[model samples]
Every structure is written in structure tokens, then in C-alpha cells.
Target: MPIDIKQFKEASRPLSERVLGFLKDHPEQAYSLMELMAELEGKADAASMAWIVAIERMSGKKEGSATLNKYSKALEELLKQGKVTEAQLQGTTYYAYGGGHP
Candidate 1:
């Protein structure tokens, strides 16, 4: 049988929620890959970003990024959608939630 859209959405929900939740809780923190994974309670793999992207894809989410550039693009889209916000720090950029562009 074909997969149901609701099931797919449900599976991807946790990944998206975890990511957004992390940014929301740590608006001022500049998290590296390791730190991000730890905050998400995900495996601290060197390829944690890639792994998360893959998992998201498998769950039927259109957001998948195996590289920093792709991740940034995806996050930018999320920001535009008002699901997240961007912050500038020492010439660097960060993502946060609840429209708090700190």
C-alpha cells in the first residue's frame, strides 16, 4: 500500500520540531554540528546534519540538506515562512524561532 500523507507528516514532525525547538530555546548560542545534535538529543555523528536531512526526506519532508549551504537555504525558506527567524552575530548568521530575530 502507498504511504499516507498524514503518516509521513507525523514522522517528519519530530525532526522539524526538534530543530525549531532548539533554535527557540537557544537564541543566543552559536551551535556547531556536535552541539546542535546534542541539543536535539540526536546521535553525535560527524554527519549529523546529513543524517537529519536524510531522515527528514525519508519521512516525506521536502526540507533536506546535506551541506551547510543547503541547510542555510532551507532555513532561509523557513524564516520567510515565519516559522523561524535569523540572527546576526559577529558577522555570522543564526536561526531562531517565534519570530524573535535577536
Candidate 2:
């Protein structure tokens, strides 16, 4: 399941596959949840996107980005299957390639 960046950007492939492709390409680099969301979505900054969601919820009483939630769920699925590693730094979770069972 070697999904290219284009496929991930266009959402032509499953979220899990797209995530794996990115992790594999980056080797051992750890990416935070928001970082992964930005990569998978081809956005330059996911924090800002999250801020938008926050503003919308606070002012407009609207829901956050569903796609970002989908990415989190997909990552959890990968985590449960031992396909990726999870770590916490400064209280924020980060994900890396391999070693999930540890």
C-alpha cells in the first residue's frame, strides 16, 4: 500500500494507508497528531486549522473538522494493530514508525 502524496492529498486512498505511506517515507521521524493531520491533508499548518475549529465552536456553535477526527481514529486503529509507535512529550502525543507493541 505505497500511496503517494498525491493520493493522500486527494483522499483517493484509505486514511490508514495514507498515514502509513507518510510514516514510511519519513523513516524514524515522530509526528504529532496535528502534524500528521497537516501532512495527510496537504495543509501547511494544522494548528491554525484547529484554531478555526475552536473559533467556530465558541462563536458559531459549530462542530470541528470531521476529517481531522477521522485521521485520529485511523491513527488509533493503526496503533492498536501495532503498526506505529506512540510517545508523549511535554504532555503531547507523538507518533513514529514501528515499535507499537513496546
Candidate 3:
């Protein structure tokens, strides 16, 4: 079945599940960390930025574990499940939500 962000948003699912649903629903759009967090949580701050960075690292960006620890567990789960992918564009990394190519 196809994923639907509206449906997931209306449900009582966890934040991580909603995030996955959003990614699945828009598999073609590339989302940077800030963009994803702003869209998902309405505001981006230290905690959210750290989570994004962690997810970026988990997506295999050239970064160490220190910055990736203690946050972004939801995205880490998605990465483990192979539901998300990363791409480098103009020297910046962006994440897309889908099983296909990034």
C-alpha cells in the first residue's frame, strides 16, 4: 500500500512512524535536515539539529559518532530498515524518503 502523510498525521502514531510515513509519501522530494525538522516539528533548534546530524551520519555521511550520538534515534531506525537514502548535491547532503535511489 502507498503511504499517506495526511493519514499518518491524523493518527496517533509515534513521531518516528509519522516521519517514516512522510518520507514514504514523498519519496521523490529531497529533504535537508532543517527542512525535514521544520516541516515535521514546526521549529528547528539545537535538539532537532543534532537529531538531523545524527540521521545524516547514520545515512553514511563523512562524520564521526560523537555528533551522531544521543539523538536522531527515529531516523536511525528508518536507516536500519532501509526506508531512507542519502545523496550529495552541491557538496551538501540531502535525504530522501524511499526504498529506491536517493
TM-scores for all predictions: 0.41, 0.74, 0.54
Model 2: per-residue Cα lDDT over 13-80, one tens digit each: 68887787788779769998888887776677878667755665667444455666687888898888
Query: Any idea what lDDT model 3 has?
Result: 0.64
Per-residue lDDT of model 3, residues 34-67, tens digit only = 5666566555564676575676678865655433
Compared with the true structure, what per-residue lDDT tens digits does model 1 show for residues 20-45? Answer: 66677776655544345544544566
Task: Please name the candidate that would achieve the greatest lDDT relative to the true structure.
Answer: 2
State model 2's lDDT: 0.77
What C-alpha root-mean-square deviation, in Å, does candidate 2 show against the real structure? 5.2
lDDT of each: 0.57, 0.77, 0.64
2 or 3: which has the higher TM-score?
2
After superposition, the stretches of candidate 3 with alpha carbons farther than 4 Å from their true spots are 1-12, 43-71, 100-102
Candidate RMSDs in Å, in order, are 8.0, 5.2, 9.4
